[model samples]
Target: MFRPAASIAGLITPSPYTQFARAAYCHGTNTWSCEEACAANSDFRVYVTGGDDSDTPDFFVGYWPTGNAAIVAHEGTDPLQLLSLNSAIQAHTGFLGAHSRSAGVVLSAVQKVISEHNVTEVITVGHSLGMLHTIAGC
Candidate 1:
C-alpha cells in the first residue's frame, strides 16, 4: 500500500521544495495538501490520484520516481472525473462503483509511468476521498 506523505515522517520534511511539490500536485487548488515522500527509497516509482463521485472537478494525480524520489502532482475539475463516477454509479450501488472507477484511472496513469520509466514496483497514496484513487494506483 502507498502511504500519504502526511502520514509518514522524514518522507516529507518541512521545506520549500516540499511546498512546491505539493502546489504542483494540487494544481493550485486549496482543497488538497501535498508533502515530500521517499519515492526513490524503493526500487519502483509510484503514482497516485484522487476523485469524488459527486463532483467532476476534484480529481488529482501524482507521480513519484524511485530513482530521484521526485513528486509530481496534477489535478483538475473536469468531465473525465464525472464520467468515471457516472460509470461507477450505473454499475453498482453506493459509492463502491464510483471508487472503483476513480481507482481505475489512477491505475491507468501508474501503468503509463511504469512503462515509460521501466518501474518495477508501484506504491499509491490517497487520503479521505482519495482513498479510492490510491487503491486504484496499486
Candidate 2:
C-alpha cells in the first residue's frame, strides 16, 4: 500500500512495521476492508492485492513515503490454504507455494517500487505462517 508522502504517520512504540502485517487480518478484512483498520498508515496506496482461495497466496504491497520504504504485507495461513500447505508437507514434496506465488510477483513489485520511487528501504512483514513465502526471493 503506497501512501503519499504528506500523509500523517503514527507513533509506533512497538516494532515500527507491526501494523502493516496486521492490516490484512483486520477485523473487517472478510469484506476486504483495511484502510481504516490501518488508519495509522491510512495514507498507504494499495499497489497490488492478490489471493483468497486455497491455491493462492494472500498479500498486499504498498509504499510508505513517510518511511521512505516499500511495504509488503501478507496474511497468515488462511484456513483453506493452511490445509493445502499441510498436505504438501505431509506428502514430502516440500513445495510451499512460494514458487508459484512470490518469486516473480514479489520481486517485480519490490523492484518497481524501488526503482520508481528510489525508496531508501524495503521492508517485508507478515505473520509466521506467511513469512515463509518471503524467502521465495532467495
Candidate 3:
C-alpha cells in the first residue's frame, strides 16, 4: 500500500529559499539573491528591511505577489547600530520607549506596507535582540 505524500508533508514547512528569508535579508549580497528568488516566484517585489545606516534595528517584511498578508522577521542587532544594544539595556519595565524613536521607523514602514498592500495578517519572527524589538513594537 502506498501512503499519500501529504502524510509526511506536515513535518516540513514549504519554503522556496534555501535559508530563512531573515538571514538572506540581513546580509549584503544574500539580500540581492533573496530578492531575485522572490521575483522569480512571483511579481512580488515589495520588500522592507531595517536600514543599513539608519539607527533603527533590523526588521524585514515581504509579501507574496498574490497573497494579501505577509510575515515580518527581525534579525540580531545590526553591527552598525551599536546604540541598539544600549537601547536594549534601557528597555526595562518602565522604559519601553527608550528606543521608540528608532522603532518608529520600522513601525511606520510596516504600517504603510500593510495599508498600501491591503495586508490583513502579519506574522512575526525574530531571535535575540530582534525578538525584543518585535515584541516591543507590536
Best by TM-score: 2
Put down candidate 1 lDDT per residue, 1-138, tens digits, no spaces: 333466556575633333433343343233333223323122323354454425321344433443333232332233344555444355224345555555566556756776666656543333333434334333
Task: Flag the better candidate by lDDT, 2 or 3.
Answer: 2
In order, candidate lDDTs are 0.41, 0.63, 0.51
TM-score for every candidate vs. truth? 0.42, 0.68, 0.53
- Candidate 1 lDDT at 136 equals 39
Report lDDT (Cα) of residue 11, candidate 2. Answer: 37
lDDT winner between candidates 1 and 2: 2
Candidate 2 per-residue C-alpha lDDT over 1-138 given as tens digits, one digit per residue, 9 for 90 to 100: 433334334333433477777775654433336664577676566667676534555777777777888887766665653445444356213336643665567678788888888998888777765565554455
- How much is 115 displaced in model 3, in angstroms? 2.1
Candidate 3 weakest ten by summed lDDT: 13-22
How many residue pairs clash in each candidate at the backbone level? 3, 8, 0
Cα RMSD for candidates in order: 9.3, 6.9, 7.5
Q: What is the lDDT of residue 2 in candidate 3?
A: 19
- Cα lDDT, model 3, residue 57: 47
Model 1: per-residue Cα lDDT at residue 102: 58
**Best first by TM-score, ranked:** 2, 3, 1
